[model samples]
Target: MMINNARHSYVCPNCHSALEFQTKQVVCQNCKNTFPIDEYIPDFLLTNQEDGGEKLKNRASRFDDLSKVYESSNWGGSPRIVVWLLTRKIRYKAGIGLDVACGTGVVARSMAKKINYVYGVDISMGMVQKAFDLSQKNTINNISFARCDSENLPFGDNFFDFVSCSGALHAFPNAEKALKEMQRVLKTGGVLTIMALLQKNIHSVIDPTKRELKKSSTDEEIIEFNKAHSSMENLDVKLHRFTLAELKMITKKIGFNNFKYLKLGSVLIFSVER
Candidate 1:
C-alpha cells in the first residue's frame, strides 16, 4: 500500500523465504508450508526449530557492547538504538514498560531506570535467562525478563503505559502480528516506538568476511569497528527492512498515529501515540 508493488517485504519467518509485499501469502514457495497473518501482521514464531537460548546467551557480551553505543551504534544496535531514542521522547518513570523481544535485557535495563517496572519478553527462554544473568551481574533489579511471544503477549490490555520494541518485529514471521500485539497491550494514548534496519541501501564499514564478531589484534585495530557495523546479513537473525516512506504507510495500517521520525540512517526510529 505504501508503494507501487514496493520492492520490499518481510522475510518468511517459518522457512526464512523472502515475502511478497502488501499481500497475504503465508505458504512459502521454497518450503511448501502454510502460515497466517494475525491481524495485519504475519506470525513468524516457528515450531520445532531451536529456541533462541544459545543466541540469547551468546548475546550477553554483544548486547553489553551495544549498550555502549545504543544511541549511536552503527551495527548491532538493532532496537536498542531506537529504544534509546524513544527514551528521550517520553517519561519512563511511574509507568510500566515492555521491551518486547529483549535479547539480553539491554533495553529492559534502560527502561527500568525510568519506569517503575519493566518487563522484557522474548519467545526464547534461553534469551530470557541470559537477560536475567546479565542484569544480575550488572546490579539491575527493577527489570524482569520473561518468555512470551510478541504475537501473543501473556498480559492484559492497557497493561503498559509505554511499549518499546526495536529489532524484534522484523525477526518474527508475522511482523504485522507482532506489531499488533505490541499495540494491544498498551494503555490508550500510550507511546509506541520502533526501530528497524532499513531494507534499502544498507552499508557498513565492518569487514564482511565473518558471521560473528572478529577480534582485532590490538586495541587500535578494533577502533575501526568502534561501532558494530551491520549489514542485512549481519543481524543475529534475518529480518525485514523499510525506508521511512514505506514504514509510515505500514504503521498507519497497524494503528499508529501522531508519528514522527528521523530517516536516512542505518536504523530508522518512529514514535507514535496510541
Candidate 2:
C-alpha cells in the first residue's frame, strides 16, 4: 500500500481540529495554534509550562538521557516476537497504526517493515529525534515520529487500526488516562496491546540488590541521601507495579473486550479489542 508522504494524520490538542501541514509546522486552522516542527518531527504538546510542565520536562529529559544508550542496547531482548504477534492480530496490512511512547522506535520500525504504516509518539524530544534519525539512516519511510503526550493523544477519535505501547506503561504518570487515550484513538474492533514490566520481575532481580545495599550502607550515607532527595519523589521513572487482575479491571472498564494476555519473561503483554 502506498502512503501519501505529504499528508499528515494529526489533530490539534487544544481544539481537536484538523491540522494543516506546512514546511516547518502544522497549524490548526480553527484555533490558530501553531505546533512547531523541530528536526523534522512535528511537536503536539500545547499545554503551558504551569500545567504539568515540570513533569513533562523531567520525563523528556530522562528519556533524552536514555536515547544516548538506547540504540546500542538490545531493548530488553528481541522485539521480533512482539511485532509478529501484533501483525497477526491486525486484520489487514493496509491500515495505519500508532505506537505510543515509542522510545527509539524499535517496535515501530519492526512493525513498519512487517505490516502497516506507523506513527510513533513520544514525550521526549530527544527520543523522537533519535527515532527519526534512525529511520532516516535505515531508509525506513513508512514510520513517522511526533512529540506528544500519551495521556492526551492529539488525534481524531477512532483513527487507528492498532495501537501498541511496549514496556512503558509502568512509567506513565497516569496509566489509566493513557489507556483511555489509547482506547479513544482506536477504531472499533481495533487491537490495543500494552507490554509492561511486572512486579514479580522486580522482586526477583532488584529487591535482593537493594537489600544488600541497605545492609552495607553507613548511617551517614543514609542521612545524606534523605537530606538531599528526601523521598523517592523525583525519580524520573517510578515503576508503578500492577497485577494481571488490575490490568483486567482497567481494560474492561475502558470498553475493551476479547481480552488476551501473556507473560514473556519479565514483560507482561495484554491484548484487547476495542
Candidate 3:
C-alpha cells in the first residue's frame, strides 16, 4: 500500500523552514538540511551531539528495544478502553490528528478511521519504523509516522485539529516543554487528549518496594514482574508521576482551558482545548 505523505505539513527543526518532501528524503530549502526517509518514515530529529542528553537517549534506547513486541505486550492497558477515551470526544470526523510519543502507533491507527488524516511522531527510530510497518501491513494509508522530539515538534504552529499523547508523558525528559509544544501545534479550539500514569496514595506505598526490587532483582524476576504488572509503575525507568493538582497547575499555566479528566485505575485520561 502506498503511504499518503501529503496529509500533514512539516518544518525544519533547525531553522523552522518549510520542508520539501522528496521520494528519498525531505529537504529544508532554507537550512539545506536534508532528512532521509527510511522505510517511508521521515527522520525529522536534528543531529546534535547534546540534543536530548543521556536520559533522553536511554529512554529512546529502551523504547527501541521494546518496539518490536510493544503492541503484543500488555504494557499499554486494554485496547478497548484506550480507543474509547481517545475517540469518544472527537468533535470533528474529518479533521487532522496527531499522536505524540506514539510508541507503536496505537493511537494513530485507532484514530485513522475517525479522522481524515493522522500523523504519529516519536523520538525512537525503531518505534517509528515499527509503526510505519504496522500501518503498511494493515493497509492504513491515512496515517504517517516520523521520528522527532515531542519537546520540539517539526510541524508549524496551529497545524492540527486534534492531538493526543498516550501512556508516555511520564517518561519524557521535559513533560512541560512537550506539553507546550503540543499546545503550540494545536489549532485554536482544537482538542488535546493525554493519558498518563499519576502518582496516587497507593503508589506511595508500592513504588518504593517496586523500585528496590527492580534495582536488586535478577533478569528472571524482572521478567516475572513484567508479566504480572501491565502498568507504567512497574517499569524500571525514572518517571515523574504527576499528581492531579500538579497536572492541573501545569495545564492552567500553559493556558489550556476546559480541562477535564477521568481517573481510571491510576491512569489519568484528560482533555483540554487550545
Candidate 4:
C-alpha cells in the first residue's frame, strides 16, 4: 500500500502551534507538551480520553444509529459493511480516507484494505478502544484511530484523498461546520461520501411518540448520560433539511465539484469531489 500518512512538521496539539521534533518525539516549544511517534505516526492527543464520550462498558448500545442494519451483537463492524454496500462502485482503494464518528472502527475495519492510511477519529473512548482492539486483531497497521472531534480534527488542510461519514451528521451540533471541515481536509480532486438521516419529518420514519419519550429521561438520569443536551432545537432552526435544492446549495457552498445525491433507506448519500 502507498504510504499516504504525512510526516509533515507538526504543531502543538493543545494550541495548534508549530512544534519541534526531537528523538522520535514532537514537543511544543511554546506549550512544553510532548507527543511520541510510535511506528512513524505521531501519537498527538491519542491517549486523551476527554474526547471519549461515556464509556458504555459492556452494556448494549441503547440508541445505536445502525440498529436497523446491525444488531446489538455485531457492534461497529456491521455499520462498516453498510458503508461498503452504499459506495462499493466508487474507487476507494489505497486512498486516504476518514471515517468520522468512527465508533470503534466498525466501518473502518472493513475499509482498511480499500484505502491507504485509514484515519478513524471519534470522541467516544469505548468506541475507540473497541476499534483499537479490532485493528490489533486484524493487524491493520495502516489504520490509525484517534481520540478526536469532528468539529476540531488534528489533520491539516488538503490532506486526505477520500472521506466517508456514515450515520454521523445527525449527532453533530453543527452539521454544516463539520461538512466544511471534512471538505477542507480533502485534496483538490478528493472525494467525499456522507450518509445521514433525512430530517424530513423524522416522525414519518420513526414513531413520533417513541422518539419523544426517549427525550424525557429523569433529571437524575440526565446527569449520567454523556449527551445531555438535545440538538433538535439547533436542527429545527439552522438545519437545511435535504430537499434537492438545499442539497445542491450545500455542496456548492462546500466547494465540491460534480456533486450527486442519492437516497439510501432514510439516509441521504451525498457523493462529491473537491
Candidate 5:
C-alpha cells in the first residue's frame, strides 16, 4: 500500500498550526511538535497534558487491546444498520467525509463509497492500524486513517462535507467537546450522524447492583456503594448514556439544527444538518 499524501487535510492537533510533511514524519509549523508516520498512517496522538490526561490514555489502551478482535466482536453494534442510517441522507458524490472514533473503519469504509474521500480517526493506534490494513488489503485508495483525539481534531475548520460517529459517543470522556469539534470541522450545511446508547433507566448498566441498592438505600449509601465498586469500573472514563431529548438539546445548543433520529432497541441513530 502506497502512502496517499493527504497532508493538506490535516493541521496540528495541539496548536491548530500548519504541518510540514516529511518522508517519515509531520512537523507542526507553529508548535514545532512532531508526529511520526508509520506504515503510511500518520500518528497525531498527543501525550500527557495535551492527550486529555491519563483517563483518555486508558480508554485508548483499552481499544488498542480490543482492536485485534474488534471486527468479530459484538462490542460495536451492527455495522450494516449503522451505515444505512448514517448515509441515508447523503446525496453528494464528491466531497470529503470524516469518521470519528472509527473503530475498525466499518463506517469509514462504507462512507468512502459515497464520498470522494474519507478520513478515519481514532485514539487507539491498534484500531487505526487495523483500519489502514483493511483499506490496504481491499485496495481502498480514497480513504486514510489517523490516530487522533476526537475532542481535538487534526483538521481545519469547515473542512469536511460530512461527519459521522457511530456507537462510540457514549464512551467519550467529554461528549459535548467532541460534538463541538465535529461541528467545527464540518462545512456549513454539512451532515452529522451519530449512533449512541440511549439512557433509558436510572439503574446503572456499568454496575447492575446499583439498581438493587437504589431501592432501599439512602443517597449516602449510593455514594458508598459507588466507592466500593470503583475498582470494577471498566473504561475508567464515565460512560454517558444520552437520552434522545438530551442529545437534541445539546446538539442544538452547539448550533446543529434539523435534527432527526431513529431508535433501534436501546441504540439511537440520529442525523442533523449543520
Candidate 6:
C-alpha cells in the first residue's frame, strides 16, 4: 500500500495553515508545531481541549471490542444495511471522497473501489488502525486513514467531491459542528449523505403503552408488547435518534441545498448538495 504524501491537500488543524510532511511527522508551516505520524496515519487530535476530547479517545480505544459485541447481536443486521445503503448511493464512480467517523473503513473501502481516492477519518486511533490495516491487507492503494476529529477536519476547503457519515452521526458529541465541518470541506455541488438511526419520541410513548398493555395479560396486549419490543431492540447505547423532520431541519439550518431523506431498513439516509 502506497502512502499518499499529498501534503497540499491537508492543513494544520491548529493554525489552519499548510503542512510540510516530513519522514515521520508533519510540521505546521504557520504555527511551526509538529504532529506525529504514527504508522503513516497523521494524528491531528489535540491533547487538552473541550468537547470531551480525551473522553472520546478513551471510548474509541474500547470501540473495536464493543462494536464486535454489538455487531454479533440480533440487531447486527443494521451494519450490513448501512454499508449497502452507502455503497448503493456512492456507486463506484470517479471522484475524491471522505468518510467521517469511518470505523474499520468498511464504507470507505467500498467507496475506494468506486472513487479515485478516499480518506477515512476517525477520533480513535484504534479504529483508524483497523481501517489502515484493511487498506493494506486488501491492497487498496487509493484509500487512506487518519486519526482526526470530524468537527475539525485537516483538509482544505472545497477539497472532496463527496462526503459520507454512516451510522456514526448520532455518536458525534456536537452533531452541528461536525456537519458544518463536513460541508466546509466539500466542494460546491458535491454530494453528502448522513445515515443514522432516528430515535423517535413516539418510541418512548409506545414503550410505556406496551408495558401497560402487557400488564393486562390480554391476548391483544401480548401481541402489542412483542411488536413494540421488536422496534425498540434496534437501539444501542450509542444511539441519539432524531426524527427525519428534525434531521431535515438541521440540514436546512446548516445551509445544505437540495436535501432528500430516505428510509432503508432501520436507518435514515440524508443527502444534500453543498
User: Evaluated with lDDT, which candidate comes out highest?
Assistant: 5
What is the per-residue lDDT of model 3 for residues 1-274, given as tens digits with 9 covering 90 to 100? Answer: 2344552377886677888888889999998988888877788776654664455555566667556446652233226687679767777898999999988888888889888888899988888988888888999988888888898788888989999998778877679999999999999999999988887543553456567766676776556545433333434556878898899999999999999999987889999999
lDDT per model, in order? 0.59, 0.75, 0.78, 0.59, 0.81, 0.73
Tens digits of per-residue lDDT for model 4, 113-182:
7766678866554455566667888788878765555766666678787787876676565777878878
Show where candidate 1 strays beyond 4 Å.
Answer: 1-83, 200-238
- TM-score of each model, paired residue for residue: 0.61, 0.82, 0.82, 0.64, 0.84, 0.78
Candidate 1 global Cα RMSD: 13.0
- Kindly report which residue stretches of model 3 are placed more than 4 angstroms away from their true locations once superposed: 1-4, 49-58, 73-78, 200-237
Top-scoring candidate (TM-score): 5
lDDT of 6 by residue, 1-274 (tens): 3456456567887667888988899888988867789888888875546874666566555554433322222112236666766666663378789999887787888888878988988876767787888788898888877777887888888988889998678767678899999998998888898887775433553456555654555564455445435533433334467778888888889989998777864568878888
Arranged by TM-score with the best first, the candidates are 5, 3, 2, 6, 4, 1
- Measured on C-alpha atoms, candidate 5 has an lDDT of 0.81
Error of 2 at 163 (Å): 0.7
lDDT of 2 by residue, 1-274 (tens): 1113524577887678888878778899898888888867888876555774676776676666556545442123226676566556666588888889998888788768755688889988988898888888888888888888897687889999989898688878789999999999999988998888777533353345345546766665445433322222355666788888898999899889988988877678889999
Model 4 whole-model lDDT (C-alpha atoms)? 0.59
| Per-residue accuracy of model 1 over 26-63 as CA lDDT, tens digit each | 55556654444433333344443376434434433343
The TM-score that candidate 1 achieves is 0.61
* Model 2 alpha-carbon miss at residue 148, Å: 0.5
